[model samples]
Target: MASASTDVDFNKIVKQDQTLCAICHFSWVQKDARCLPCKDKVHIFCSDCLRQLAHNDESHAEGILFCPVCKMAHRWTEEGVASFPRLDLFNSNNDDDDDGNRLRMRSRTFVDAPPNHTRSYVEEIIVSVLRNLHNQEIQMIQKINETAANHMKKVREQRHKLLEEVLMFYDEKESELIDIIREFAAFEKFSKKVGETNKKVTKMKIRLNNKANSCFHRNIEFIKDSSLADFSIGLNKKEEEFKVSKELCRLPTGGRVCNTSFFNDTLYLLTEKFGGSLFFYKLLRYQMKTGIIESLHEWNNSIKIEYKLAVSVNIYLLTVGEIRVQRVTETEDDDGKFSCTFSTFYDIMRRKNDTTSFVHIIGYEKGIVLCCQDLDNIFTFKKIKDPVKQKWKISLNLPLLKIVDMRINSSQLFALFTENLHYIFDLNSGKILNKLKTSTGSPREVLGITKYRFCTKILFQSGCCLIGNDFVRLIDKTEDGVSSWSYKKIFDLYHTIEYGKCSEGIIAFLILDKWINTVYLKYIKC
Candidate 1:
């Protein structure tokens, strides 16, 4: 009576215990081939099924086959999964209250899934071996919570410091304005007689001219902390180097470097391809910190480089020299570091206007596309999408006059000049917000605006009458106040300025010394 029967129902037990493929109907007899990437011992279906899934996907052109089950789930090669922990069939070390998926099996108990009544079960040994991973996940989640708490604490502290900075900034500017107002008031009190008032004004003017003469124009190198001062010209060549990615960008042998632009810490080098387009042949990204040069994009021959090119966040590169194409669209997902992973392209459909001039494509910058027909008085303001039409792209218009020398500031503002009148356009809507006449004479539109200086709240406007001259203008406004960007400071560079770009705390300029026939690269940190 104590001895158990030796002959049992072997076929019945085999049918009950054998693992079956989720895809293939075959009962897998081998204990191996569990998907290693998955925490639970997910049975790997036959390779034929996996192969079929990969080829059937029409969009998998990049050859990066994704897991069929879920986008978040990943699968490991079955052949290489041999080193993973083996199945433990009879482990008693399992929680009884566990009710999670078997892939992350916390118990050896078999549970039936609904619908087809399929049983999902795996040995407890799998969980025991993968217990370290579960523990690590718990630790990571705790660390993330702690980091978020710390970030919130720091943000509160930063808010106070930022308020102080803004207050101090207004204090200095307001004080200067008050002094100027008092000076004008004193002019009225000087004398009622015309001769006496003219004599006093001449003396005041002479004194002001003398004060300006005393501060002689000085150009010197700044070794450190040159944020709002003269640009500290140099590169950290010891730590960083520059190289180009030849795979994506093609640069022919002995190709002459034509132009350069720097924005968002990435330097764009425009080079002319031999036996190809004489204008912009290729666009390359020079990541100075890493000293790597990769192709930004190989533009079609249609984009001819112009004296001025515009860069903005709305479009990758609108300065597609004179956008000849009636349809304009762009995105910057391919831009390194500054690119948003989500691609945003807009449709810039242009209606033929016989009264307008040629389509002047400033140049491509970020993702924003801005187009305006000169004589139409209808400025096209396009964005990524329009829910109104349930389409991926949208084309809209903004009412604006003939505006030129359009340049982007650090924020969503475009500075444009029409004669002596300066206008700030709302970036997204492209509406001309305000206009102020410049006292610094007409800003040299040929040179355009120098963008923002690194991290500082300063903008440089090219003001020299001659080409290849560097002029600095620090423009600022608080809140919604209407203020003119007066002539503040004119910092000049000796070398002829070829091209300049500024973004993300770095300002770069490509300069050429005609006398020496030498080209130089200058960059300043904010």
Candidate 2:
């Protein structure tokens, strides 16, 4: 009978290719439901379906569950696993060697009689004990189920209290924020008249947060009077955690400033000369400590209609229709003589559009590396040769197009796109490491971004500061070691930001006061 039943079940599985669950009555593609060893073929759709049956079978309240359809005890676990992971299978006292004194796991279906005992007498004694043991199991499971229900009820009540506490926390934080805002508004209004008399805000030396770059130990707090404020994300909301914004100096140019770069503590600003000037453009190097023009030179004939400027250590590389490296000796004072010489450094031409491109330079091992952005791709050129007649050759290429901003470290490149995306590329392997969209939050430590349509980047001591129309996001590239690195954002927001540059942790932005239609150079520490 068993053989005939097994054959019929096999044929049904082979021909129909599915089985209907005995518990749920659902068709499944598995060869057969996990069933007990029985002549009658009973199907259990899946492990979950059988588990539901075991949990709800009140008849087994204090005993082991049996098959619902066949009422036969069998292995319910899935194939290949020895036991369920949640079960505690350890035994302090083992019963592997039996001397007819105690019945064990196998004694449920078959008993082993000792040689000294009569078989019939042994069988009668074992059957009587088995009935009593089975009743004990029923009582144990009933207590277990009752304890579980009572504990779960207590946990649910506590969880409801926890939810209420969380909501209260959020409400308290919101109220405190409103109070701070009111306090700042009143203070600023009171100081309005005194600020117009003799206003002078001295720029302070900005210190870099040389701490490790991980979000594990940060306490995030937002504080902005205007926009989605700057979070002084640090170990604590300490006074040193946040930066002070002060007036640095009014820009030398009243017309406008463009293509700005900062290296060391010096500021390099490109200003166009208008209204009867000898040159079309003038590049000024201003010292931050003295607020005086260190050097001013005519840079008209060397650039095209459009150009980009980058300062690396002491070398200044400019690009537009051509690439020029500003002579390092330009730092020396001429007394009265003016000598601002730039040798044409644009030699390699990979494409026609490469002539007019955005350029950035960084000091590599011995020479300098020139990073250029064409219409289709980004090409990096290494200055392989020495001092005499320096030449730039193509070193590597990355097929990342529409890069609005590019910031380079020793081993990685942070490339930003106008489409609200940013990519980090491993320069050593020329492979993309990570890609992320500019957003305010994420699953991991969400480094923030303010992806305006027009955004630019300026490198700081340990990171790159991304500047937009009103928001600034700092990308910290602090490597845990020389071989590895991580990203962090010290984000802030402002108003009417036109151009920006950073050195160490000091940032200077040319902000236009829309109320008065005037521009001011402001400095802030990070």
Candidate 3:
């Protein structure tokens, strides 16, 4: 029976066999669905089981379903089976009948057999569902990647803007800080300058105080006898009595007295009636016995007839009209005789123009006459040279204005004027060394022998007197405007005069009356 079964037509059996599973080698009756290409039959159980196997291992299942017996995948669908061409095995006239039948059987059998290994139906279904879910998950991941990329881009943009804003804020703050630093630097510089100025002022105040004390001590001897004869007299004449008179004297021209100055031990009186006539009187010796009144040689032809005289150690200077200067000297043999040694005539004349018309004789030095003409011109004249002839030899023409009076101290020249103008010039270089101006009023007169170490008493037309040492100390003014004697004060002897032997000293001037006098007291060194 086994031989007969083996001899049975295997080709026919295989071709007719529709009872195997395509995915797994299972009986056709066990699977519901059949693989058409393979012509394998399987039961309902096999179909579900094959599907389950295919789902569980989809990569391997795709290959298995295409082929069963030969392990080759089906090239065509079941619908093409009827028209599908088969390979030729033998020729009709050839004597190879056995070989042909064996080839046909092998080929037919290969086309109908199913592959091995079936999976559970439930498991296959679960695998298919999982595959679908995996595909959906991949799509969701792609979307999430895109959204993340967009968010990152937005964050970068916002960060860039924020960084820019922060930089701008810092720039503005830096600029403000720089300005504040500059302001602070400027304030520091200003404060330093103020401190330096304060120090200078303090030093000046201390020096001035010392000078004031010295001047107070010298005044005691200066006030007693300021006349040249009295100055020449020794201090032993402390008990000597001198006469004081207010008696009026008449001039040769019958003019009443207007002003007077004692020069070379002689009294020189000026009369208003004579325009500028000068009367000279000699000081005679009483011999402690006989008293005598003596006459001095006088010149009635003196220029302009009415003028003011300024006396120094051995010379008398007179100013007549605008820019006119004359010098009077005592004759060597006449004891009290006087003569005019030199005179200057000005070419330009402008009234009330103080800058061009005024001539002030400040002092004398080493036979050289020191004087200031007008506001800017300072002249020095040799003893033998006429002022007009030496005009081209003027020492300096300092640029200044409103000068009222001037004085010389050593190598420095001190000038005082209105607008609080004060100038100190160097004698050697003729350059201005220092300058000071007052804010209150113009200086009426500069009275002292030293510079930066003496008292300056300024008389204002408004009747105010300003007193100080190298600086303004006090101002005393009268209410009335008409009084020429509007200002009055007492100056220490040391500050007012050069001689240091003076006792108690006070200088009182009546500007309206044109009277000047000195009072003497005891000396105190402190």
Candidate 4:
């Protein structure tokens, strides 16, 4: 009875054994099929379909071929790789029973090639690469030679014109000398002909003296006013000597100054008092020339003045609770007062708790931007025409983080984070375009940044100055878009520095000597 049951099960299994491809879901025979190296060992598809799938699944970067079923990578099996059409297999007048054995024997013979053959193949590839490199070098040398020839031609033309001018001036002077010699000879003849006291002799003597005098004046003028003296060649040299003028302003109470900015070319310092009830915070205005420190205005309110910004003809004084705009006028009165009038204050994000928060302000295009130091919140304010309501058009928040310093140009902003990371972001979209390391070697000891010329230090213009206790370097971008620092010992090292933009290539920075309790106004020629 058990033998009968086993026979029935074997019959059932053989009846259900029909081969179907996993990929196409069509019936396939065992002759034209391949399988992945998996535990199932079931026929998947034909070798052509498997090769196509492998080509599609190959990852160029990773340099690996993946299995379609398991989604895992593996080396090619011998039988599966030999089934490819391009590979030439051994042909013999044999039936299908001996085909697999013959193919295995042929593959083994191909793999056992001579060692010298592999070595020669690799050497040929290396020689081809070297030849290509030599051709490129030849082309580069030709380009350089052509460029140098053009520059040399221009230099030769300049030299020819200068030498010609020099030659012409000397030639005319030689003619003038000949005329003077003739005048002297004629004067001697006249003296001999007329004897000492003759009337004609006196007139001739006067004429000779006048002619000689005119010739001397003309020769001197030509030599002195020549264009040869006007030629100046500029060399890339460091300017070490600076014309410095310094003044000192002594503060009565050593209040912690928050920030500094320039408006209408005048210096303004924002100071905050810690505990005094007389004046909580004050804005001190100093004349750049006279070094006069006068309190422009004082506020005793609970909300603190964060920072001041001068953006596009408008002076914005931002505080924690409200934003104030002072219309910076072009005219100033004789009493040393700006013709600026304060507009009605606009509201900011109010303080949640008693915890202190610092707001950094930078003047951007057509508006002013304010950022909080603690939170990643940014706001843009544009002064509108209607003063009564919504005078400052505030934009949506910008997600900036841990901003330590910010420098603004017309288009972009360079935000320096607390971690010494520098980010360049566009103004309109608020998207970061690039990030770079500000310093490479030491712990960051950067004090602040001062805007110079048109752009800041990260840009490729007349670079700005970066002030720090360890070093004060003028950083500029190179042609390959890398920032390089030109170390400058232009100013004395101090604890804190606050600068205001003066004329082109000039800046007025205040150095606060913490030990002496004195502030020095330093005018720098950058």
Candidate 5:
């Protein structure tokens, strides 16, 4: 072979062996090798060189080895061999297979490996979760703080507002007290002056007593011939008249009449026949002086009238727990006979099953106002457009209970009780202005009487004559300063006599005599 050898081309031979190891300069025909991270023709790695490189690395405990040239890591076995195999360039001839192998190589280099749950990846995930939890905690704390701050701000504002209101109230109270103190000082000065005047009067009274004593001794001899007659006379005038039966007027056709009212110089009587119908009654109207009773209207299918109030030509009759407004109209025919017609009934209060509970019914303005027995409450109804339609207007809760009678005077409503206590209320404002205890004790009945107007009064007992005693006193609110002026001696009634409604200058009284069991009307001059 040496004798036949010619000049050999070394460059050609080197070029023919393209698949060789770049790390050891070994041919791929004798040793196993892999492409390095560069993946070029000259940069190929042999297994032995890779083993030696992995053995010399400090990070090999992680089961991975990396190339020194490109710093690309590869998975390595415990024996310091590359676990991922590379395609041999000298064996493959299929283009598809070569493309697939290149694709796999690129995938293995770029794609992530199996998750290392025990190392830095898990620690990083834990750190990120902790960071999110910390942020959420900070956000919650901020929200809570904001809520607390808002609540505190509201509390402070409310506190300041309440403080201002309290201060204003105290200032007003102080001003009132100061005015009261000034008035009290003036009252004390006047009282001292009155005391001095009273002392002088007492001295004069002592001198008068001495002079009277001397005069009595001087007139003792002269009184021997003078006669002293009995001074008690006419003390039982009304008492004597009550024992005798005095006829006021003849009885009407109706069986018996109890409640009566006088309006516009005419007497209105409520008469009901006994044992006929318990709930029906006949309303009779009679002239004051003529005494001729004629049937004005009959209340059929209604509870008997208990209380009534007449004002301004309209008669308010309370029957079956309802107050009705009745108006009488008169018309003259060609025959000169006067025909009267009653107006349609206006329903004010239609309480169910409360037929006999009414204590008083007062017509105020255009509505009906009432107070019941044993009830400390009062209610008012207003007149609507239609007479049949009425609405509740005012409801007042009174401080004093056991109200016996109530009267409306202008803008004030006066309520009287059985214990000599009276209350004054504002009609428009529904506020109780004052409650006063009168000097009179335990009134059986209280009548708010005047010479010009109709007022309220409780029904008096039979044979009761309110004479000489202070029955009622009109209080002048302007000058008297809530004190009553003088008691007005109104009237004295006989036995079984009851006072009825009063208008301007006249009042009516009904007398039920037991002699005939008949009802008579007595026209009283006011």
Candidate 6:
């Protein structure tokens, strides 16, 4: 037979017989005959078809190959043809008659294959198979990467959310802690205040108890002494029988008694004499049984005599001089011979050139208060050691319009004067803290002003004295407005007795006439 390559159109053969071996069909191609063992025979000229057939026939190692036209099994080998076991075919037996169903057997003849053959169709098939595999692998890798990236992004978002939650929790915890601290501080402060209040209440209770006990003792004493008190009625008396003797040292010529004070059962009489001479007399009450005459111990010239006596207590006598103070004291002796002695003197006069002019003494402990026509000043003394001397310590100036009378109550001193003025001053500092004006009667000439040590009663002259139907109106410069002075009428004439004690509720102004000897005792409660 002529060469098939000369008779075959190679392009038409390759397109028509895609499953036929190109070497068998006589195409100018190199055949991959090793892939033909599983009977997946195609054109060897198409390399793409060969590779595809080889991938589909993985059982080629078992050595089974078949030719489509000849229907014959062949052995696959790269070098030479090899023998392989054949599959058994069924034979028609004598039991079946030759009807139209008789077996139609087809015969195939094997041919010897050529080696080292190259086919263009085989090369194309191999290249196409590799390209398809590469494309599939690339698509799978892209999907895996996308999945991993998505998972990482989700993890980051979760971490951020967790951090936010932690911060919020911390803030809440911090707020709660701060609230607890503030509450604790408030509790501490409240507890402290409660403790302070408790202490104050305890102190107040102690003071109240002390005051109650003192009042109780005073009341008991008053009850015990009530019986020994003397009671007299009316003011009538025999003036000639109970008379105040005139033998007592009379006032010096051209002098008058300005003020007087009784202390330590002795009398301090201050007399204003001419030439600014002050006659200070220490009067002792004569003991009727002793037969010793009570006489004036010492006499001295004072700076001025017109000043008022502010305070007189025990042996300490404070006298105000002209712009100075004369403090006197009695010498200490066991003989009981009452004699007045001069302690020391100090000058407390201020410079007249200073514009800040103040001259008022409101209170004193061991000092003098100088009472002028419209001013008052205090001078205190201090005892000096080493040389053993007393000196004027301090001076307090106050606003007072003629200190008419002053009474002490504990540490406070109440001073009454003209212009209806009343000043309450500190006894220590002599500084006035309160002032009041009386609505009615003027504190003009205080006849008998008394202050009960145990009571809050102040008694003063009202400038009105009644002797029966006669009203003896005394004219005086008082804190109140001025008024005319006269007697309303004259009643029965009577005698008078001037001796009295302030402690007695009733002062017996004894008055007696020829008709009856009745003692009119005026009972003043305060």
Question: Model 5 over residues 138-164: C-alpha lDDT tens digits?
Answer: 566667767867777765775575556
RMSD score of candidate 4 (Å): 30.2
Where model 5 places Cα greater than 4 Å from the true spot, the runs are: 1-247, 253-255, 276-280, 289-291, 299-311, 322-359, 364-393, 398-403, 408-421, 425-433, 437-526
- Per-residue lDDT over 1-526 for candidate 6, one digit per residue giving the tens place of the 0 to 100 score: 1011111122222332243444344322233222223334322323344344334655435553343344444443342221221111212333544322222111121222356755477766765675466456656656776786777676567557555655665575566556655655665576577773463433333233223322222211112233422321112121111122222122223433444443322334444444544554433333222323344354546544344333344323344434444444444458755556554443444656522222333223344443332233342322222123342233334344344445444334434343444554444555555555555344432322111111112212312221212222223333453333332221123222222232322112222211111122222221
User: Which scores greater on lDDT, model 3 or model 5?
Assistant: 5
lDDT at 119 for candidate 2?
A: 61
Candidate 1 runs further than 4 Å off: 1-261, 273-280, 296-315, 318-366, 375-404, 428-431, 438-469, 475-506, 513-526
lDDT of 2 at 187: 47
Instruction: Kindly report which residue stretches of model 6 are placed more than 4 angstroms away from their true locations once superposed.
Output: 1-256, 272-293, 297-304, 310-321, 331-341, 345-352, 355-400, 409-412, 426-434, 438-526
| C-alpha RMSD for every candidate | 29.6, 18.7, 39.1, 30.2, 34.7, 42.1
**Candidates' TM-scores?**
0.33, 0.40, 0.30, 0.40, 0.34, 0.30
Model 6 RMSD in angstroms: 42.1
Candidate 1 lDDT, 279-395, residue by residue in tens: 445555555556555654554355455422233342243333243322213335544433222232323345665443333333334343345454545444332322212112222
List pairs with backbone clashes in candidate 4: none
- What TM-score does structure 4 among the candidates reach? 0.40
Per-model lDDT = 0.38, 0.43, 0.36, 0.46, 0.43, 0.35
Candidate 2: residue 147 lDDT (0-100): 82
> What C-alpha lDDT, on a 0 to 100 scale, does residue 141 get in candidate 6?
59
Backbone clashes, candidate 5? 0
Give the worst 10-residue stretch by lDDT in candidate 1: 239-248
**Candidate achieving higher lDDT, 2 or 3:** 2
